[model samples]
Target chain A: MSDADRVKVPRPVARFDDVTRRFDGGLVALDRVSLSVHEGEFVSVVGPSGCGKSTLLSLLAGLTAPDAGRVWRRDARPGEVGMVFQEATLMPWADVRANVMLPLTLLGEPRGACARRADEALARVGLDGFAHARPFELSGGMRMRAAIARALVTRPRLLLLDEPFGALDEMTREAMNDQLLDLWASSGLTCVFVTHSLYEAVYLSTRVVLMSPRPGRIQAEHRVDWPYPRGEAFRADPSFTHLRSALSVRLREDAVTPEGGAGP
Target chain B: MNGASGRAYLRWLAPLALAVAVVVLWEVLVHVFAVPVYRLPAPSAIALALYDGHSTLLESAWHTLSLALIAFVLAVAGGILLAIAFTRSRLVEAALYPYAVVLQVTPVVAIAPLILIWVGLDNAPLAVVILAWVVAFFPVLSNMTLGLRAVDPGLRALFRLYGAGAWQELRLLRLPASLPYLLSAMKVSAGLSLVGVVVAEFVAGAGTSPGLAWRILEAGNRLQTPRMFAALVLLAAIGVALFIALSCLERRVLSRWHESRR
Candidate 1:
């Protein structure tokens, strides 16, 4: 598409308006955080460990309610939004197919349909022939792949991932990132990815959001301004380096600041 | 035999050889010391007694086995259902859990007479089964309760995210997660049930039908030392057999997933 066409705004798939969340000890996790993700967009939220990035995804997934303000989504029904946590979280007792089939199974779908969808999902994540294999038999990356397959099996419109590749080694993580982008591009699913890695944010997202810790709030948003199907060559591009360095510097500034203090 | 088969052969042979050697030594010592048969019967004498009273002894063995097995099945069913109740409601667990512990800590020997009295001496078999169930059910209840609560938080969150209802959560997630704990508890219960049956039979005296324990008591009264030894041997064999069978079932159920099976 031309720049003119790309500049047109799409419909919002999900929105968070002045959302505030607190923990049991009254620690503010996110304060007055607002974000809007557009249809077919890849939005990556980057922050330090305590920046409420995970809590943000939790809100979108409807696993947690915002203590204040409103979180809205176009499709809020069950199976409309898929979530993947940092850990694969596949049931140890179940085989890959059964684990992937869980969402449909819970919805009371027919057994044959559940199995077929589960197998198709497994194949999508390159886990064909691994349907019958136990989760214990998979390697770390393969286990995460199975988790992603499970998340995708529901064919959700909106995908919320909370550092799903964080535990993986650098090489495996990069490969997964590429695979995730491929899935997103092919499926046209809106994605909101949360990660600590600036390189990952820049490489995979259409918009990279940086958050400040100590009651997390959106500090900055950078548009990647790059075309789709970004490959290995894009990583070496000067634009990619510049954006990554900017995010790194911004993150360091936010990290060193004390609670209730301003960054220099 | 090849090396792998040779190792397997040795594994089987070692235990068998030790048992045979012990029996032979006991027989020889009894003969050499001229130990009176009433005090300790020779292995050969015990064997002969077992043969001579095979019909009566086998019938008694079957009675004890069936009683223990029935108690075991009841304990398993009751324990799991109670555990599910405990998981679904905190109030039920808080109210009833202490009593379960009380039942466990109280000795079966102390309560067998009370059970017999309550169940009535006329229904001695039912009382015996009830006593056995009391002894055997606690391990399964406590373990399953813990297992249900010990679910992975992430998995729990995932299930909730998918909007799984309470029954679906139990059926798809909690029940399967608790299988290993349940199986291990079953192993412990299997042995405890047998012990409970023996103790209950002893307390019941001749009021109940003749079980192996009853046979042993009768043999003791008459100074039939070989018969007592023979009954004791059968009881030990049953205990070992029950433990082995439950262990095999555990391996079968858990081999695909559990670390203990590996």
Candidate 2:
């Protein structure tokens, strides 16, 4: 396809126009969900626990389907949806290299072809010399790294993360967020990061979509203006603090009062 | 209590001292009690019996070893085949597994004569002896199957994502995972196979292929207590040799990967 035919950057597209997702017992997980994510955009969706945050990812990855409406992506092909689950989903029996190489192998690439790429992917994730180490040998943070490597090995255009570091300690999670940001900036890949932490959402996303509880609906959306080359200082900014507190207030109101007031 | 010496090597002392003490106690007890040679022979008398009956004992020992070898091979073949079938599905495991348990649980002595009759073919008597070999074979298979499937789910998923087929998964992951279980099972089966051969001798006495079991029987009938003890010790020796060999193999293979090696 010609350059003109291709969609523009920062206009990277995820289409979920009028999407409605209903479970078996008429539990609506998503209602009329319409959102678009531009190319190379970092988007985080936050909600209370059991708010179908994971279900959104599942829909995007085609692991499950939306009950109504479409989730269409023009830039990414079907095979390019790389998903990282909440758990460190690395294969415990597989060494680091083999675990990362999994997507390539699943795509039916030859072993000789994937071998060096697998090593490179591991090295890229800071698991350079530990290529032969099993998942059990690695720490929780390291194992999550291996999991991320597996997702990136395929060079996916659209990455879907479902609370990827929710289980990690605060310090490790911060380190991971920086690493993830660096990777995202370097690779120029669009990401949909699902998180429960308001600070994390504000910290990582260029666009933050706050979701309301059970029968989930998007309560509001905010465009984060924190400049990139975003350092620890950006997190300490008054603007960052105000945005976080505002988002938390909106989330609290959405749950307890079942009413969403207009933003100031 | 938790000193470095607490983890000190315990090499050979326990067994060596136990053997020496047992021999010394046997000598003193027999001398003090004046136990007749026809009843329980002293260790020295048994040693003498071993010295005198060297040629005959060697012959019978060889016979017994050969029988046990053949029976063990049969058991291994049968066990491995059944194990493969069992691991394939819950249905196959349920159907074929129970009969194996029946084969094991039935007393060898009571069934030996009946097995001798039922063979109705050449080496039928030998076959009856081999029947005892079938006992405990599946324990190895059962344990091995458990080990093979015991791989972590995440690991299994990794393999799947790599597009590894069933054969590759089995060859690389399943079989290697099952090695410890297989080795332990081999240890148990090895000891049992030896016992099976000797028991067969008790049933099919004084035949051309009659083993140490026949010698044991003959010595007992003739009031040759020392000869009986000598044969028992030799059997014990064979069992020890096989057990030690299997243990070495287990250690050698696992030491590189397993922490228990240290």
Candidate 3:
């Protein structure tokens, strides 16, 4: 879509307005970062290591507060936000069903209702038969599926994923990417995904936000105009390759040009 | 037999064979050297003593076992409760944890005589149980506190995002996360409790209805060396039995998820 059309987008379901976050020992994790994620938008934040990508997601998830500026969530309600970490983070002692049921259980839902909801969430994530299996009994991808099932069980409006596929093999990562897109599409859930892989950002996101390290700030934003249900054909398309390479070149330039007062 | 089962068989057989060899050699050497029965009795003589005093020995064993079991249950319950309190309030932990460490390092033997006197000879069994509980409480407290605090940061954040209250987090996450640590601590404390009971009985003298340690002391005074050896044998058997039982419990609890079980 043209820039003119982009300006016509509706109100954001979640937004960060000129936000800044600082850690202990005077480290600036983010600096005046403004981003907005509208309902049903698949937005990916891409940055190198130590580039405040996670801090961005953490702020959006309300896991951490910004040092300055405003974090707004439209119609914020209990259990309205779900987060998936880089690791599966499943309770080693709990079975998949119990793990998925945890949010509802904590909310004081009835036992029968929690069980039915957990089973439904498991089925949504294609984990129907593995509800009774322990976390250790699952493969890497399957364990991550269990984690997603857990996050999705609460039926949150917005999902924040922090490099959820980083630990998976390449083939498994691609499969999970496709599955995540399907989940996002069918559920009408807004997603703010963080990753370092430009290819992944380009393949899965409606808009890619590039961040630079050393007091992280948004360096660029690219609108991906690819149609929905993007598949292997999109990966082989010349436009996909051009956009990915252009992002890579911009990232390389940022890496070479060191910011003053930033440590090596 | 297949290799795995053959290896399992050998694991049991080797220890049994070694024990039998040691006993037979002891019996043979006592006979060959003509050692006085007062100094070192033959295995057969000790066995005869055990058979002759079977009723008395069994009674003493039962008394000691009961004291140890009571003390063990109290230690586990008290330790876990204290650990939960510590996790909930940093001020409580800071105020009380040093005293716990001091209690652990003071040596139960040094305090047993004082404990016996304070509790009075009329309540000697209670004194023994108290001493044993003191000895067995520290491992569970320290290990469980560490385990409760060792929750994965991601999981902690998830719990927070889901708005789990303190009690819910403890029941669903902290308590289950700390189980492997608690079970291992229980194993260590089990052995310590048995040791504590025997030492406390020794210090409490014959006032506590003649536990095995008292039987050992009584036999020593009369120069019934075989009976003393029999008492020692029973004590060793009790210790081994407790360890094996605890190990089996640990296996049952941790076999599904714990890395140590694997």
Best candidate, TM-score: 3
Which segments of candidate 2 are over 4 A away from where they belong?
Answer: A1-95, A102-108, A133-138, A158-169, A192-201, A206-225, A241-264, B1-8, B54-81, B118-133, B159-164, B177-184, B204-208
The lDDT per prediction is 0.92, 0.79, 0.91
Q: CA lDDT of B229 in candidate 3?
A: 96
Candidate 2, pairs of clashing residues: A12-A38, A12-A39, A92-B155
Decide which is better by TM-score, 1 or 3: 3
Span of 10 residues, lowest total lDDT, candidate 2 chain B:
B1-10
Worst 10 residues of 2 chain A by lDDT: A255-264
Q: How do the residues A1-264 of candidate 3 rate in per-residue lDDT, one tens digit apiece?
A: 688777786558988899999977779999999988898899999999888999999888888899999999884765788889999999998889999998888888999999999999999989999989999889999999988988898899999999999999999999999999999999999889999999999999999999998889899999999998999999999999999999999987887687533566
Q: Candidate 3, residues B1-262: lDDT per residue as tens digits?
A: 5987889899999999999999999999999999999999999999999999999999999999999999999999999999999999999999999999999999898998899889888899999999999999999899989988989988899888888899989999999999989988999998888998998898875755579999999999999999999999999999899999998988988877766662
Candidate number that wins on DockQ, 2 or 3: 3
- Clash number for every model? 0, 3, 0
Q: What would the TM-scores of all predictions be?
A: 0.93, 0.77, 0.96
Q: Which lDDT tens digits does candidate 2 get at residues A59-102?
A: 77666689889988764453376777788766544577877887
Interface RMSD of 3: 1.3
Error of 2 at A31 (Å): 9.4
DockQ of 1: 0.67
Candidates' DockQ values?
0.67, 0.18, 0.75
Candidate 3 chain B weakest ten by summed lDDT: B253-262
